[model samples]
Target: MAKPVLLNNITHQHLRVRTGPGAEFGDNQMAAPIIAAEFRQAQAHYPIVFRPTAGDGFEALALFGLAAGDNLFLSNDGWDADYVPLAVRRQPFLIGVSGQELTVHVDEDSARLRCGPDEGEAVFLEEGSPTPYLEQVNSMLFALHEGMLEMTGLIAALREHALLEAFVFEIELADGSERRLEGLYTINEEALAALDAAALDRLHRAGYLLPVYMVVASLSNFRALIERENRRYAVPR
Candidate 1:
């Protein structure tokens, strides 16, 4: 039996494990036991984070930033920190598994895995590889990718409803400065006039419109018109 490691409270919602070290496992195999073990005998300490879709029966671990001589555990059928790789120790994250088919989502450009019941479990690439930051980045990127299409659809719906035309936008900067952006297109002035101050504030808070100095003209040449207006009015410093 594999022993569980003594991990800091830092190990919380971010940890995951799959049946195998990699994703190529056949359906017939029983679910592999995933375990996070801390080595009391070893000087190295790498926490467990994600298990890539590869390497059957292998476990992976993570440490945010590790130095030499750090002891950690590598669990397959048992636990041992001696086998953990040294080169991967320096990286913010590491994947250590026997086989090469581990599917790891590293960055924004990586191909997203399809969503399904068989969406394989997450596991460690190696038993004692440090990868805290990398695991967080992967989790966030996957979430953003999954929701992007839905977000785009919502934006399109808002545009088609002409709800975007109700107001302008003004983006406040971190330096206490501001930039005014035009609304989606134009406002139905009559409808806007009917809105109370609170309603208008709600729209502005929701990013429907931005406030600016002045408007010169409504034309296909809006960019040129803005330049002309800025010269005359000297747009807010």
Candidate 2:
């Protein structure tokens, strides 16, 4: 679905990406895939929850809203959160495989990309090299790539331990309307606490304990999500 093209001066000398947020580029429903490497940071701001993938096992995500097309984080002003996930940060650009090398590819149809140099941030320097903004995007992409690679093993650990459990969230809006959010999973703390000594040691040795606990700790952010929603609906607009 993405019309990605290799980022090159000849074909994209006028590339500029819009700065700030407000879902200007139609990214209102950005799904922030939280990885173990960023659990500490992500847990501070977003509710880290696991969602099942189609034959791909589970993925940890920072909950941006209660449902699709409802990113409570985005407003006319900008993103409300302090920490934006790496997946959401790398917009309009992606890592492309060219032989054995990874190159930058820009989404040609992205609303973020502009034709004029006067607005947004330039992708390339006036002298033809990558700009600082592009460099940052490159770093974000590489980090996200590596983080995703690490998530496979982390999720496997949880699955192998049988720690994943299904959950459903029922919410009551300010107007007294009730909605149910389903098909989510969470780490089973009871089973985690029931693990034998050797099993605990194995998880600790594998550096899995912290992320598991991080997920447990992040569940509290659901309260934050509720607060944001309440505020959004409470407004006259």
Candidate 3:
């Protein structure tokens, strides 16, 4: 497992926590470390990860070392002072690339927005006027549809009977309250298999799995039987 490292101390409100690895240089990609000083005091470190980006920009990812569990507080990055509560009620967990821009539907009745990606440096969308939170709600629903599809792929690859059965996750709220989420949701394999390409595309267009990241697997944590199989297939060079 990679240990967390300190990145910065400044708490800029516009900070966005995205899912992509930072800029590429030559053939190497930079490690996106966390800024500890801003959120955690000088004492014990909070279970948070920070990745500093170009120009004073930064992104945060909270971790609780959960395997197979769902995280509800992952949407803290998309929270706004006025609409965060509404967002929390709808969908608490989020899955996507860490730093990609997101377009939010601000008006419930009209798809037009008061603001756009160009106006803000972060990954949220808003309108000049306040419509019922319903518009923003729809946007979130759309995003979640996509997120589930991308997450399903990762989950499917990890669902071997001997590999894993449970999960643990961390949830970080806007008010700085962090909670752990751990549970089991019956994997509906039949339903997942029935999904058609068009349904999958709708999820993708809604920004569920944009900016793909690596599907991480821990060799050290694999079951002994699985490890033996991996060794059997290992290429001898």
TM-score of each: 0.23, 0.92, 0.22
Better of 2 and 3 by lDDT: 2
Whole-model Cα lDDT of every candidate shown, in order: 0.31, 0.83, 0.30
User: Model 3: how large is the Cα RMSD against the reference?
Assistant: 19.4
Worst 10-residue stretch by lDDT in candidate 1? 211-220
lDDT string for model 3 (120-166, tens) is 12322242332344344445555555644453443333232221233
What 10-residue stretch in candidate 2 is worst by lDDT? 22-31
Runs off by more than 4 Å, candidate 2: 235-237
Off by over 4 Å in 1: 1-130, 166-179, 183-237
- Candidate number of the best TM-score: 2
lDDT per residue as tens, model 2, 1-237: 679988897677768888667565765773567778889988897878898887878888888887777788898778877888877778888887778788989888887875466888988887788899989999988887787778888888898888999999999988677667788898999999989999888888988889999999999988888888888668585
Q: How close to the true structure is residue 154 of candidate 1, measured as C-alpha lDDT?
A: 31
Please report how far candidate 3 places residue 173 from its true position, in Å.
22
Q: What tens-digit string does per-residue lDDT give for candidate 1 at 147-195?
A: 3334344334334434334234444434444445331233344555566
Q: What is the C-alpha RMSD of each candidate to the true structure, in Å?
A: 22.7, 2.0, 19.4
Query: Which candidate tops lDDT?
Result: 2
